[model samples]
Target chain A: MSNTFLIILFVLIGGGLFLSFLRLILGRKATDRAVALDTTTLITTGFLVLVAFLQGRSMLLDVALVYSVLSFLGVLAIARYLDGGLR
Target chain B: MSFMNILAHVVTGLGALVLFASGLGVFRMPDVFNKMHAGTKATTLGSVLFLFGLGLFEPSWLPKLFLIILFIVLTNPVSSHALARAAHNEPSEKPDNLIIDDLEESKGGDQ
Candidate 1:
């Protein structure tokens, strides 16, 4: 049953990631791409956490935690740069 | 599968479905603010739901899962807010279908 759930999740996240890529490619504004990138990082974090659950490794959750924090910083930096809020 | 396991499956599945819808919104939304609205809100909730589902499967992991979810909830809106402000000020990408330029008006400049 869990295996079936895993397969279903894989398909769902995969489709989401694909859509994010499409938006990133077709986006006219940098902010649109930023939003897409943010979504992609989120999906990746969820994927990492799922992998940790499947593999029975607690350390991978830490990786997901770090990845999320760093991605937030990345988005903030990009936003700051775009807004001329940075010196 | 037991009822508990079924519940986990249902919750996680819904989370993933929400993430997919967020991506679709990003692809189809007309402007930056709309896209940010869809992306941040849905994805934040979806990720929290996903973590909560996993915590249900293994009670031992619940604390850490909650921590992660809390961080996401706090940061997602903030980052989106910053990005929206930036997008509004961007010189090259004029927002299509913009209804109000309150920020522009407040700036009191022709920028």
Candidate 2:
């Protein structure tokens, strides 16, 4: 039963990722693309958590946690650059 | 047979739906600011729901999931706000009917 639930969660995360890719392809503005990328990162974090559960590995969550922090900082840096405030 | 399991599934399903809608909004919104709003708010909440559901399903992962949720709530809005401010600063061909120029006024001089 847990395996079945995990499978369903995988499908959901996969589908969300595909949709985020579509957004990345269709976005015309720089900010739009940035937002899409941010969403993609968030979805990836969720995906990692699901994988951790499937593998029964507690250590994977550590990686996901680090990724979440790094991605957030990345987005902030990009935003600052785009605003011409990076100096 | 377990109510918690049923609730977890429901929450996960809802989170997926939220994420899907956020993606659509990112593609369909008319302006960068609107798209950022949609993507940041919806996807952050969706991810939180997803992680919470996973924690419910796997009790052993409760601590990690809660931490993920906390980080998301802390960072999502800050990043989005920064993105929106950045977009506002960059020059763009305005839409035909845009009437307000608050940012322009704040700039104190026309570029």
Candidate 3:
């Protein structure tokens, strides 16, 4: 990827992350915050992958992959807890 | 410079834009269920397209990107559903605009 393209991608995802954070804090309910967190994690994974391209490193892809999996697990746990299913 | 490079740039740019839209949806939507819909559907697509474009730029990294994309696609909707269901079951905090709740109708005993 070109340097300019990388910059644009960074700005776009950064804006996305910022908005997601806004939603997280402004959320009225725990479920709303959870959904915002899920969105944030998803955007973060995409950002990480874009950074991998910028840095030209395959190792970063592994980090993104693992991070995505971990976040999904966390979302699941939060969902179960919210529903009173975990108890 | 080349056709392939331009393809990567356009695709990646558009993908990131979609992610931004998803965030906007989460922020501007009226209720939690609507926020879940926007956040999950659009972000799932944005991540897939963003990674696909990235893979086009660097073919060697495509495999790992594919893995991450698949994981996002499979998990996103499921997690959204779980969250929505959890929210719906909260009798005190029902969404104000929830229309025609069939789940509470068909299976009302549990809730």
Candidate 4:
């Protein structure tokens, strides 16, 4: 039962990643791409957590945390830059 | 097989579904702001739910999972707000059906 559940979870997340990637590629504007990128980062973070859960390893949790923090910073920087910065 | 196992599976499955919804919304929404609305809020909730479910699966990993959730809660809004402001500043990304122009008027006085 647990194995079936994990497979379903992976399929769902992969679909999300694929759709967001589609958006990233087809987005017309810079902001559209940025929004897609943000969604992808968030999904990736969750994926990392799920992987860690499956592996029963604590270290992967730290990796996921760091990945999220860095992605947050990246998205913030992109948003501020696009906002035109202290105009 | 166990009660906790079943609960974890259900919660995680739901979280995955919510994440899928967020992606769909981002793909289908008409404009940048609409996409941000779905991407930001849904992604935050979905991630939190997934992390909580994982924590349930392994009791020992609870603290760090909570830490991840805390970071997500704090940063998701800030990033989304910044993105919204950016989208507003760029007239090209503005939604077509937006009836109110309050932000346009406020922008001059506020910033």
- lDDT tens digits, residue span B1-111, model 4: 899988987888889999999999999998898899989999999999888988888889999999999999999999899898888888777666888888888888887
Clashing pairs in 2: none
The CAPRI classification for model 3 reads as: high
Residue B15 of model 3: what lDDT? 94
User: Which residue runs of candidate 2 sit more than 4 Å off their true CA positions?
Assistant: A2-8, B93-101, B109-111
- Name the lDDT value of residue B33 in candidate 2: 73
Residue B104 local lDDT, model 4: 88
lDDT of 2: 0.81
lDDT of 1 at B64: 88
Tell me the tens digit of each residue's lDDT in model 2 across B1-111: 789989988887788778767777776778777777778888888988888877887888898789889999999999998887788767772233447877777786665
User: Candidate 1, residues A5-73: lDDT per residue as tens digits?
Assistant: 778888888888788879989888888899888888987888888888888899998999999999999
Off by over 4 Å in 1: A85-87, B109-111
Instruction: Tell me the tens digit of each residue's lDDT in model 2 across A30-65.
Output: 777788889888988888887887788989999999
The local distance difference test score of model 3 is 0.87
iRMS values in order, in angstroms?
A: 1.0, 1.6, 0.9, 1.0
Give the alpha carbon lDDT tens digit for every residue of A1-87 in model 3: 556866777788999899999989988888889999999999999988877877788888899989998998999999898888766
TM-score of each: 0.93, 0.88, 0.94, 0.94
Error of 2 at A85 (Å): 4.0
A best-first ranking of the candidates according to their lDDT comes to 4, 3, 1, 2
Model 3: pairs clashing at backbone N, Cα or C within 3 Å: none
lDDT tens per residue, model 3, B36-89: 888988998899888999888898887878888888898888889888888887
